[model samples]
Target: MLAMALSTAPAHAEDGYELWLRYHPLATEQASLYRSRASQLIAGSATPTQTVTRKELLSGLNGLLGREPTSSDTVTSDGAILVGTPSSSPLIASLRLDTKDLGKEGYLIRSVTVDGHTATAIVGNEDVGALYGAFHFLRLVQTERSIDRLDVRESPHIKLRVLNHWDNLNGEVERGYAGASIWDWWKLPDWRDPRYTDYARANASIGINGTVLNNVNAGAEILTPRYLEKVKALAEVFRPYGIRVYISVRFSAPMEIGGLKTADPLDPNVQHWWRSKADEIYKIIPDFGGFLVKANSEGQPGPQDYGRTHADGANMLADALAPHGGVVMWRTFVYSQTNADDRAKQAYTEFKPLDGHFRDNVLLQVKNGPVDFQPREPYGPLFGAMPKTPLMMEFQITKEYLGFATHLVYLGPLYEEVLSSDTMAHGQGSTVAKVIDGSLGHHTLSGIAGVANIGANRNWSGSDFNQANWYVFGRLAWNPTLASRTIAEQWVRMTFTNNEAFVKPVVEMMMGSREAAVDYMTPLGLHHIMGPGHHYGPAPWDASEARADWRPVYYHRADRNGIGFDRTRAGSDAVDQYAPPIAAQFNDVKQTPEQLLLWFHHVPWDYRMRSGHTLWYELVAHYTQGVDDVKHMQETWRGMDGYIDAERYQQVAAYLAIQEKEAQWWRDACIAYFQSVSGLPLPSGFAPPQHDLKYYESLTFKNVPGYSSW
Candidate 1:
């Protein structure tokens, strides 16, 4: 009867809807081992966080152990899992674990003795800490780690690890590839979706504590009373998971949403309007995180429109949120056509001067690179230059420039590269990681944000490998020092089979995937040459756009004399933004790393590369190398059919085929264009493109998905 009942319970095939929380029944040996340790639950707390902790533990335990565990106030039997702070449970109090320095969100899971009973205690200083501990405990079993004699203490290094969703009010997502917006704004205040709770669970499992629900290119109507009620509903669903809600505030909300005449940051009426708005938000959602502002960039109205500075605009909102303990994530992605000297140097030029001017509650959210999220970019110079202000790193988990979701490019290596790059602000050892983690500058407040790639898709990130990007971002945000390779390995083991045969090769493929994308799409630091408007395929010869910087011809100045942007003192002098030693290296063509050679210098077509080939030959070789890598990735995935679910396996297989074709398109079109400019023959023994230059240029994406944001 018991076996029959178990079989009758509702279950679905693994279509990746469960994400990494797929607590499927483990291998017989592992399941029995975990069952021996987690036979009963002894959760003695009833608070909201504790309730979720109890619920999660029971669900995970039932799925993995193949049977539900009995909940008990006291552990009368052995193999009991005790989860709660000392104050909430007598069993946890008797163990007397030292949780003093664990902080409010940190926890320690240990094997301890209580009342002559041997048990595993997930103890913390608070209930939310215990909740985090619960997720970790399940992860141990899911990853098939030994639970015997466990003694682990964990805490988040960064204070505000968050996700910035570019989802809009009307079910559209800017640069979002997965699907339509998940937030059903029309039915949200009344019809709360169960998916919202699942989203919160996924974020909390990975230590992501906050989310901005709207796009940074914000709509002011989102600030009105109607939308506030919808935001409050989502916040209620997320509150127990320790995730707070934030909004992307349009800088001119006072004028657009309010009845103010002039939306100047210094204007008395504008300041008063913002303070009242803050109070209104706090009344509905008491723990609302704060505002994320993008001002005076890309036609967005800002303080610069009112003859004030970026600091003035940010400080105005910062003052309003101060009384409520909210903050301002002032974006530094500012650029204008008037100052179109170097797109790579614009953010640093603007924000570096106002280093110490921001209020204590405001954080300057700088992108991982100086320019937009290219396939590969040097660390943003503003990271180390601003010491007095808290500089939060903003990474894009979405694949905007790197083939969107169709390409299997893992972003772990990309994140690791920017974080590990040394800034030399406090001498030789100051990595960008230290600067953002508040260790190098000794600033109390610190954070890291990712432009979330999540949407309404069932798989959540469009593809299985793409989920690794989202997972890695949250993991890195919690602790920037963690290795990307390590995170990739863990994600693979949990998301797929733990079998070593599957884990090793998949990790190897992921570790090199980003570099592969870079070699083909934007090798040697060639940036922003994708198709205009839709950014789908190659368009290197495109120069017809009105704005000079918006066109591909402006970035890669390929001519008969040379084929690169010169950022040396004679050119745009963008290399001068870096620290003196770094700038000196970048200014010298011979000293610049070959990966970034084209980014910093305008070299001759006949210039030699370290690979013993002319620049023309080396460039062609990189494009072909990228195409070859995609072929290799496809071959690797074809052999791992039994490791993961058939649905995800086929989805990844189909996407890899798409990537291979697109990679070839990039290689051929870019080569054809550069050859036309340099007037150079193809490298000896190298075949010409599949089509002529005009043929490649004639191909267009008339209706690309996820393009028309407006």
Candidate 2:
């Protein structure tokens, strides 16, 4: 039986404004069972967090069970839920559950008998943890899990699970497809949007404890007193939900805001200015998380401006924030046009030599791939390479390269693939997950940041499915070992419908969505071929850009004889950056995974693939398969009309239609360009490109959304 049966809600449609917290009424049988188990709530409301926790439980229960459970101080009823910390509730303290081992943010939910009345106890070491537990309890009811013998204990493996917003001060979000920035900077510091509270609730429910508010390509004005007050107002709203706000800092802020001549890291005046700024910020927002710096990359100012190392820049800010318990997240997405070597190897080349030079509070925030957020790429070499330094994974939740918000690309599988990858730093079993969780390096601080796709859209993420990317990112940050399929199943049940027939196929579709995108877009490790600036559609022939690395032709490097970048010993030698075992495997063309064949080696067009087909034939097959997969997705969603509200269902249906048309556009364009380069005919039984090479090359996009004006 479906947990949340077909909605008893009025025929009025849903606009997906409620995300996964939709606590629609459950089926008769499920509701009766859950209502009996939740007859009374005995959670305390002494603190602001406790008050919100109580409010959430009441709201969720009222919606899910069709009525609010009686709120009480003591568990006199048979099926009461007693939730609190030892200090907050005497009822919880009397139970004497083993909460000593549970960390400050960890919680234990167990069934206990108090005064001969059977009750569920949600115990934590802190109020925020109890709030988390309350959310988990609501999830159980939402997902129709049995609460009869509940003994669920949960804690975040990563210390700083944060969302990195690319929102700018001008209210424009770089690479944000949903809408304008959600901050409403003009109205903030005076008017706190109720949406901010909902944002905190959604993040807290998934165990994300921190958020970087501004773009890493930051502006100096954000550091001024006026903006600091605005940030303080937003912090107050998020504090109750346990979310500490962080900001991306302009590296030359001392020069721009403090009226300093030079913002050198080693300069005494510069150091004093940063210290004073930190003190000022802490006074306004005491629990403020530290700076996220994109210095020395993409024209951002940094220590490099003063001929100092990345460590010099990061440590300078780390010192100022150390007294206030803040840490600096220094981005490792550094590349320069001066360096002629592979763009993929630049981050490792630059940061590897500076290992252990950083302060203990500084985390080297590395992207999942050595390159930018490509549709698919190998795990970054820095994961294991920087064992002496604390490294946090930075994933792009925005689908900038994967058809923006229109394409149904579930990033859960992509995140899981990167986290579960074995870095092999300490022989075997040293996964990327271990590296970031402080287990591999035995370091204390750990974190993972997702470049948030959230905007002012009613759905939060641009589309209903895009919300799953945000949802899964938080879930995996809490526990990296979780299966993407499991997360997808949970999201499908909560977001749309719990009907088995509707859920099973939708989960399957989501699981394969990323791979389908990879096949259609950048198959066989061909990365960064999207249109320049906006990164909308395929632009395999786009080479007019002034910089060699920024052009599409720079990456694909297609020629009349063959295709693919040569990163072997004879070429860029980028494979040597990985561990010796991984290097050896990638060095051998036959040994490298076919999915990443083009990433490491330049193979001839007629070379035989593992499938015994020629390289050209395999490419055509994969592209064809991708289009077929999107068609299958369309077919799958077509049957889900009545499963969810017509408004959301029809919107999803329309987006899928758009995705199919664009997938075909990607297929036809790429095939035309590659065929023109390789001088190869389309494989037998395959359809030729709809247009000639010139047509695909002539395509131009204007006024495209999410362009990085900065």
Candidate 3:
């Protein structure tokens, strides 16, 4: 049905040059107000940072407001927009803003009288804050909001909002869906691309101030002097946008790059080597954001290789960087084969015991889920378990599990689910957002990092809709309290048309996308059912992987009599990790939310659901409903043909077609395999699988795109 809708549309434009920053012309009224208020600008001294800020404001105003603001030395009458810091301009000082409260990165925008002229002023404590404020002002215009009577003061809720790019030097991106890696390592130090500058602009537009530029499956060569120069060039490009570049330092860089016998933290030679490396990096890039380490996980080397703890490894790097004001983001995605414990439980077990042992400069980067980014896993136990340690929430913005780039799954709701969850560590309202932002734990430093899905694709993210996930992540990382629906509305208004006709349907489609995906892929919390290695599609019958943990059966634990992994006290007791009230709810089958029914209980096929249908029938209905929802989305988008641009409309229509096809594939494969095991007949009026179980099981694609070895 969706494929038909797309086939009727014209071919899409191949150029993806305009990312979400596409400042298309607004309605007549919006364009008029923007042009009047942002007609001319009087900016202070033109430093490198200020130049970037001026160019951005001019370009965005030209694109969005239908007029360019000319730069001026003095504020003119009536409608000039003034841009400067308190230290640079007397006008800013006279405004009497609480600049002390804004820190270095915060900004204030006010309509004030400068030299008896009514002018709008964007003032900040520093030049970088001015750049941020400039972008904020542009966003309001881009979204077609009034600029008159502007009185806005903004500060980031979290100190560090960073994007962790899993981009390798060889041009392959780990779990990246858009295209090949954006970094062209072959032509680096001398041949810097303008796209790098645009990338920095996009990050600064949202409140993201830092980026880790290498894969966590890191190469020691990144720390070498040769690559340090390459990294310095990238850093220089990003510096003006208030972005600090960080690297994923291979844990054994001391051994591989420094020719050390052992990369042990306690070894004086290794400690000295790391300190010298930090000095070398800081010398080139002064504000280098420091290291992101994936130690003792998936064959990655760490201090644990020598019977030392994670703290020992992190603190060693922290000591090296403390002098340079750098921090270490030590990843807590570790699990040991020797321990034979649940992978979900291993990270908490390893790090919870060493809470206060970490240096102040070190942050424990924990994944949003206990396991890998499954469709729906309970929040990782590490959130509230470590009070003394600053834990940064690591969210995968890439759709590795939720049908990769093909499916239109908005992840804002998923992020909100985890952030708003009551961890109950300190009290009733101990949300995960509080834990990461240092409010609940009362820690000095706080941060949140998103695993970037950005690539060389013209649209930045692979699909047009995938860009929303990236946008929402940055927005939520800036202010975790914002509702997913609100973000979705704003994104729709900016990315597409702001017309109620377009925004309402698109927002509705986006709001239900994740749940629709969960329904088709891992409904009722049955997770880890994707194919091994690539994780492209459903493989519930898969059980012959090299490690028991890698197989789908290890997660689902389905049998002829019943389905689901019983994580109650009788089973793994994973529920015991949560607070008492939450733990007790998850432990009881009757009390548990139906969304997480299969996560906690092994239920019979005939178990009655609250909806009065048998569990098996309800599962079938959910999958069918998910497919129907995709069909509905296709219809809704088709109705919006004249509303959006022809190019984007066709592009999104085509992707929706692909999504509907894959959703059917998921529904058919999962139902066939489940029914084969359950030995139950398809319920009356429920559609049967289009293909046999064996036919669906035999599906394979050895050469799928984006499955790069790097």
Winner by lDDT: 2
Model 2: per-residue Cα lDDT over 1-710, one tens digit each: 11122223443678776789888888888999888899999887778999889888888898888888998887787999998999888888988899987898999999999989999999899999999999899888898888998889998899999999999999999999999999999998898878888889899999999999999999999999999999999999999999999999999999897999999999999999999999999999999999999999989998998999999999999999999999999999999988888999999999999999999999999999988999999999999898899999999999998889999999999999999999888999999999999999999999999999999998888899999999999999999999999999999999987899999999999999999999999999899999987899999899888788999898888898788999999999999999999999999999999999999988899999989999999998888889999999999999887888888999999999999999999999999889888888888999998888788888898978788688
TM-score, cand. 2: 0.98
lDDT of 3 at 179: 89
Clash pairs, model 3 backbone: 16-458
Candidate 1 lDDT, tens digit per residue, 325-426?
A: 999999999999898568888898889989899999999999999878989888999987998999999999999998988899999999999999998888
* Model 3 worst lDDT run, 10 consecutive residues: 1-10
- Which segments of model 2 are wrong by more than 4 Å? 1-11
Which ranges in model 3 have alpha carbons more than 4 Å from their true place?
1-14
TM-score of each: 0.97, 0.98, 0.96
* Native-to-model Cα distance after best TM-score fit, residue 687 in candidate 2, in Å: 0.7
- The residue-by-residue lDDT of candidate 3 on 1-710, one tens digit each, is 22112212233553445555766667788788767777678776558888878777776777676677777777775788888897887767777777788988889998887778878989889998998899788878877777788999988888889999999898988888888889998899999987888788788888899999999999899988899999999999898888999999988888897888999999999999999999999999999999999999988889989999999999999999999999999999998767766667788888888989999999999999888988898899889789998999999999999877878999999999999998889889999999999988888788999999899987788888898988899999889999999889888887777899989989998999999999988988788999988889889999878787789988888788989888899988878877888889999999999998998889999999999999999989989998998999899889999987788788888989999999999999999999998999988898998999999988888966567663
Task: Order the candidate numbers by TM-score, best to worst.
Answer: 2, 1, 3
lDDT of 2: 0.92
Report the Cα RMSD per candidate. 2.4, 2.5, 4.1
Residue 628 deviation, candidate 3, in Å?
0.8
Greater lDDT among 2 and 3 belongs to 2
Hey, what RMSD does candidate 2 come out at?
2.5
